[model samples]
Target: MAAQSNAATAGTATVQGLLSELAALEDPQVRAVNERHGDDHGVNLGQLRAIAKRVKPQPALARELWATGDTAARLLSVLISRPKAFTAGELDAMVRQGPVPKVNDWLVNYVVKKSPHAQVLRPAWLADPDPVVAASGWALTSERVVKSPDGLDVDHLLAEIAEHMATAPQRLQWAMNHCLAQIGIELPEHRAQALDIGARLGVLKDHPTPPNCTSPYAPLWIKEILRRREAG
Candidate 1:
């Protein structure tokens, strides 16, 4: 029993150290945890979550960041970039910044790819009143929204996009293909619309501009989606 207790204590310290490191990790937070240099930048997400589960449950840094919404909080609340547990308000701000490419990149890569809170983000975003914010709702819905066994009211969403597609071609194009790549066409009608919109919008096209040279796969899907729409 004594030996077991000693082992547990050692493990606890290791876990806490790991969490603090992740709360500070940045660059590798993208690319699904930067396989080659994960150790250097920070630990991978799966390990972070597991360790956090065992440690004293602290409110996720994102929750505090959302409540605070200050610059220092943004820098300090590094865990907001992680999928572990995101505050709803911060999620709203990220989505609101949808029109900004940098914000989009952060939302898709850091927040969506790394975190599971996307599930919580989808529905609320889908219902946003503003088209730009609603565009983000569609954008993330395709990426992180968990597929429901019963299914989503995707037709209404598509109709909503189509209604605005001509006027807001660029945004509509991005949102549709975003869904297409992630959600796929399980629903034949939605898939047909998705492929049509995605292909028309150039949903799969690559862009000459890159966000970071080290990580080049930035927003090609959106470029392609737009291209297809322009051609059609």
Candidate 2:
């Protein structure tokens, strides 16, 4: 019992130390940049990744850091936590927490996608009332649209996008647009429909893109990616 108590105490001290490290790395300029992208953290992604590299994977530590509600710590937790260790319900609760865009994106991409529960959680989140949760669901669906699409209804997905892409919330629209692009890029039979729907809806058409970056406007994005593939 004493040994277990000591171990727990040591874990607490380690989490505190990591938190201090993250705080020290924070910068106002970094925070401003992240804020523009809808994230609240100030730590440079390179620095956060460096910290994750030094810290061995620890599920308990990940949980503690995530509970503290610091964006950078949460990002680190997503990196260090064992994805499959989380229960389906726990993942659901985490998504429903509506974390900032970067954290939510990382949690879904890095953690939830690897979970055995991903397929199980996908539909529930897709149907969830919360737009954020639904956006995550769409993100997962977009993955399936590329990697494991035998069971998905491509027509129905396009239908939904056609009906809702123009009016859905920002995050959800982005995710749905991604699914549309995946369909256009990966499946030849649906490419025409996907492109048509994208052209019709015009979502993200005016989104400011950095120089030389592909536009997120689905029609342009689809053509640009396809053009690159043809060039190579």
Candidate 3:
């Protein structure tokens, strides 16, 4: 019991030190993140990565930091978290607690999908009524389709996209559209079908495209990414 108490105290000190580093690095002028995610600590990805490297992976400390931290600290917590340390209930609470869309993206991609527990949680998240949960589900689906589409019901996924893409909450719509783009790009058998859905829905049509990047309009996005891959 003494050993355990000592370990807990050590973890708390480590997390506190990390939080101090983040606060020291915070830049109030980094308002672009605030515009994009409604939260910003002025810490860039590079700084986050550097801090993550310093702290290493301390999943226990991560949970403590997340519980008491602000947006940037939460981001740091996720960066240093180990997927194996969390239960499904804990993951669910973390997702809800980190409500910003950018944070959700990080949690789904960096934490949940990488966890051994992903398969057990994916379907439940998809079926959840919460928009963020459903969006995380779609993000998981997107990762699955890209990495392994073997047993996935292509028809069912397409049907879901066609039916719900228009009315899905903003974050979910982004994810669902990602599903459409992934289908069109990754699975040859589904490409034509995904393209058809894109043409019909005109997903994100007129969303501005940067000079070098492809547009997010689904059909064009899918086609361009595929073309680039082929060229490379």
Clash number for each model: 15, 0, 0
* Per-residue accuracy of model 2 over 93-122 as CA lDDT, tens digit each: 888774699999999999999999999999
Off by over 4 Å in 2: 1-13
Q: Which runs in model 1 stand beyond 4 Å of their true positions?
A: 1-80, 97-99, 112-117, 144-150, 180-186, 193-232
lDDT against true structure, model 2:
0.87
How far in Å is the alpha carbon of 71 misplaced in model 2? 1.3
Q: How displaced is residue 56 in candidate 2, in Å?
A: 1.9
Number of the candidate with higher lDDT, 1 or 2: 2
Native RMSD of candidate 1 (Å):
10.1
TM-score of model 1 vs. true structure: 0.44
Q: What C-alpha lDDT values do all the predictions have?
A: 0.48, 0.87, 0.80
In candidate 1, how many clashes are counted?
15
Q: By lDDT, who's the top model here?
A: 2
Per-prediction TM-score to the true structure, in the order listed: 0.44, 0.91, 0.89
- After superposition on all CA atoms, what RMSD does each candidate show versus the true structure? 10.1, 4.4, 4.8
lDDT of 2 at 160: 88
Worst 10 residues of 2 by lDDT: 1-10
Q: Per-residue alpha-carbon lDDT of model 1 for 1-232, expressed as tens digits? A: 3322322432343323433444453344453444342222333446444433443333453444434433223322343335556566656676564443433544555665455566576677666667656666676666543355245667666665545544554554556545554433344445556555544544335545555432111134434544566799
* Ordered list by lDDT, greatest first: 2, 3, 1
